[model samples]
Target: MAVLTYREALNDALREEMERDDSIFIIGEEVGEYDGAYKVTKGLLDQFGEWRVRDAPIAELGFAGLGVGAAMAGLRPIVEFMTWNFALLAIDEVVNAAAKMFQMSGGQYNVPIVFRGPGGAALQLAAQHSQSPEPWYSYVPGLKVIAPATAKDAKGLLKSAVRDNDPVVFIESEIMYNLVRDEVPEEEYLTPIGKAEVKREGSDVTVVCHSKMVHQALAAARVLEKEDIDVEVLDLRTVRPLDVGAIVASVKKTNRAVVAEEGWPMCNVGAQVVDDIQREAFDSLDAPVARVNGLDVPMPYAKNLEKLATPNADHVAAAVRHVCYAD
Candidate 1:
């Protein structure tokens, strides 16, 4: 095992996958010459040359469409959007073409491609740049969505996503890329998609979350521990093929739950989780399922406003307390 940053782990995953499969290639803006927007693709260009590590223009629509076509031709392509906000321009290709191609064509064409990039709010990316689109893609039928919260998950899940035989939306976060570091296994491994991981176990309450919110949930759990409240942190790594079984198991054990997410509350991932919990573990639940969601407003330009809009440890703690009836 080696302690690595989220960026380094992702770099390792891409490198290893490309090395293992000659057909796998990466394409996006500044991916080759500039080494990626967040330097996640650092040194990949020199190692694999410009052909494999390509840098496209500032055109998301054209490049994303091209990648969809390439995937149909039996090449595994990794398409990076500078940010998901930019990927919005290419949603036509992602949702209409890549996502529905296989099933729409009766399995004649499988778009084995991965669309990845930093998503959700950053330090002060402002309204246009700050947004979380996981629910938008996860709502589709043929697409798989994953958001890795740890370096180990960042590496393992990415490898699995790249190798999967379907379209996947691999969402990363600018807030977590370098801020969170952990020991990731050096051996070749794959974290199966559609599985949830219990990050920190407890008995009082279950905290459901993914992406950067997982860090906040962990921090909140630590604080709650001081007051004799045992909080379990459940990371929903894969959003689309959600590990509903894991969620049910956690809720059954804890009997109380709180969901944390960076997205707005309405029709968010948390709502889906809440529905699942109420249906499968309704009798197990001791209290109502509470959620710590992002402030239901467009992201503001001010730094403080941005902070308030994003979910933090304090927000998570309050939600957990509410579920536990300690608020």
Candidate 2:
């Protein structure tokens, strides 16, 4: 096992996958010469050359469409958006073209593409750049949404996304690029998409979250431990085709659930999880499922206000307490 930061694990995965597959290529702004906006593609350009590590113009819609076309033409393309906020410009391609190609073609074409980059707020990036748009893509039927929290999941799930025959939206947290670390397997591996991980086990309550919120939930679990409240932390590594079985199982075991996210509450990923719990594990639930989500208003620019807008460990803990009736 080798300890690595979230960005390093992603770089390793990209490098290894490109080495294994001749058809795989990366295309995005600053991906080649600049080594990715967050340096996740650092060293890849030199290793694979300009032909594979193609640098693209700052046109998300155009480049994203090109990636979709490339996928239709039998090449696997990884498209980086710099930040997911920029990806809003390319949603038509991602949602209309890439996602619908296989079905539109009547199963004759498969868009083996991965659209990735940092998501959610970082420091004082404010409203324009700090949105968590996972649910936007996850709502689509043909797209697979993945938001990995740890370095290991980031590496494994990315490799899997690269190999998947469908469109994938892989979101990473900008704040966690250098902050999150984990010991990854030295051997090649793939963490299957559509899975949830029980990061911490407890019998009193379950805290369901994805991406960076997993760490927040873990921290909240620690806080609850002092109060004799056992809190289970379940990371929904894959947002689309969510691991409903695992979530239901966790809720059944804990008897209470609190879903958390760095996104808004209305029609968000956590809202879906709340619905799932009520339907699949309604009888098992001891109390109503509660949600801790980013403020409905646009993300604030001030550091203190931003901290308050984004869901954190304190917010998660409070939600857990509400559901567990421990407050």
Candidate 3:
């Protein structure tokens, strides 16, 4: 087993997939010559040549539309937006064209495309670049949305997304790209889509989270262990087609749950989880479900304010304690 940074894991997935299939190509701003805004695609251009690994102008909408057209024309394209914030410019391509292609054509055409890049708040990046759009993309019916939290998941999920026949939104958090390291399999592997992985097992409380918040939940679980409060952490690898069974079973065992998310509190991913739990696992719960979410405000430019706005270990721990000991 070799340890890899989140960025390297993603790059490895892209490189391996491209080598295995000639139809797959990567196109985005600075993805080739610049090696990506975060260097996730470094050295790819040289190995694959310009035809396969391309650099596009700073036009997300233009390149994204081109990628969609290419996918419909029998090529698999991995389009990278520098950050998800820039993806707003290409919303029509993603929400309408890519997501609706199969149904719109009555199954005559399939868009095997992957639109990915850093998502969520990056410190000091300010409001323009700091929002999390996973919830927005998950709302669309035909798209597969994946937000991987660990190095292993990053590689495995990206590989699966590339091979699928439908368009996928692969989200990676900028904060986790270089900070987290984990053991990744030497041989390539693809984690199944629509599955959840339980990072830690507990019998008292279930903590459902994804992406960077998964780490926060795990950290909080570690601290709660010292107080004899066991917390089960469920990493919902794919937000859409969420693994509701895994979450329900965990809640059944614990009889309590605290959903954690990095986005705003209103109408967020966490809200959806709580809704599903109440609908499917109502009798199994012993207390009201609690949600730990980022403050409902634009991410601030100041480091301190930004830190305060995002959900962290302390907030997670507090929520877990509240739910576990609820009267």
Candidate 4:
């Protein structure tokens, strides 16, 4: 096992995949000469050469469409947007062409590609650059969404996304690139595309979350541990094929749930989790499911307001306590 930073794990995944498949290439803004805005693509240009490791002009719509065309022609492309916020510029291609190609063509064309980048609020990037747009793609039927909270899943899931035949949206967190460290397997490994990993097992309450919110849920679990409140933390590794089974099992054991997310409360991924929990595990529930989400307003620029705008450990912990009636 190797203790690696989240960025290093992603780099290793791309490097390893390229070695195994000559058809795979990476293209995005500043990904080559500049080594990526977050340095996730550092050293790839020198190793893979200019053609495979490429840099694109600052046009998300154009390059994104180009990548979609490449996929239709049987070339595997990893298209990195600077952030999912910038991905809004290319939503048409993602939602229309890449997602609808196979069904639109009666299974003749499958756009097997990955659109990846850091997402959600990081420091104080403001409203334009800080929103979490995962629900937009998750709401679509043809796309698969994966958000890894640690280095291990970051490595394995990206490799799996590269190998899959469907279009995948891989969302990373800019603030977590260095903050999270995990001992990743030295050899090749691939996390399943539609699985939820139980990070911590408990019997009191279940906390469902994904991406950076996983960290918040884990932290809340540790705090509740001191108060004799056991919290089960589930890292929803993939968003599209929601792991309803894992969530239902956890809720059956705990009999209460709290969903924590960085996105706005309305129609977010958490809302879907709540729907499944109530539908499948309603009889086991001891209390109404609680939800902790980012403030509905646009992300603020001030550091203090930004902190308040996002969901944190305290908010998550309070929700867990409220559900368990331990507050």
Please give, for residues 23-67, the per-residue lDDT of candidate 4 as tens digits.
Answer: 999999999999999999999999999889889999999999999
Q: In model 2, where do residues sit more than 4 Å from their true spots? A: none
Q: Candidate 4: global Cα-lDDT?
A: 0.94
Error of 1 at 62 (Å): 0.9
Worst lDDT 10-window in candidate 1: 318-327
What C-alpha RMSD separates each model from the true structure? 0.8, 0.7, 1.0, 0.7
Clashing pairs in 4: none
lDDT (CA) per prediction = 0.94, 0.93, 0.93, 0.94
* TM-score per candidate, chains pooled: 0.99, 0.99, 0.98, 0.99
lDDT, residue 216, candidate 3: 95
Model 1: residues with Cα > 4 Å off, grouped in runs:
none
Report the C-alpha displacement of residue 206, candidate 4, in angstroms: 0.5
Q: Candidate 1, clashing residue pairs?
A: none
C-alpha positional error of residue 279 in candidate 2 after TM-score superposition, expressed in Å: 0.8
The number of residue pairs in model 2 that clash at the backbone is: 0
Worst window of 10 by summed lDDT in candidate 2: 318-327
Model 1 scores a TM of: 0.99
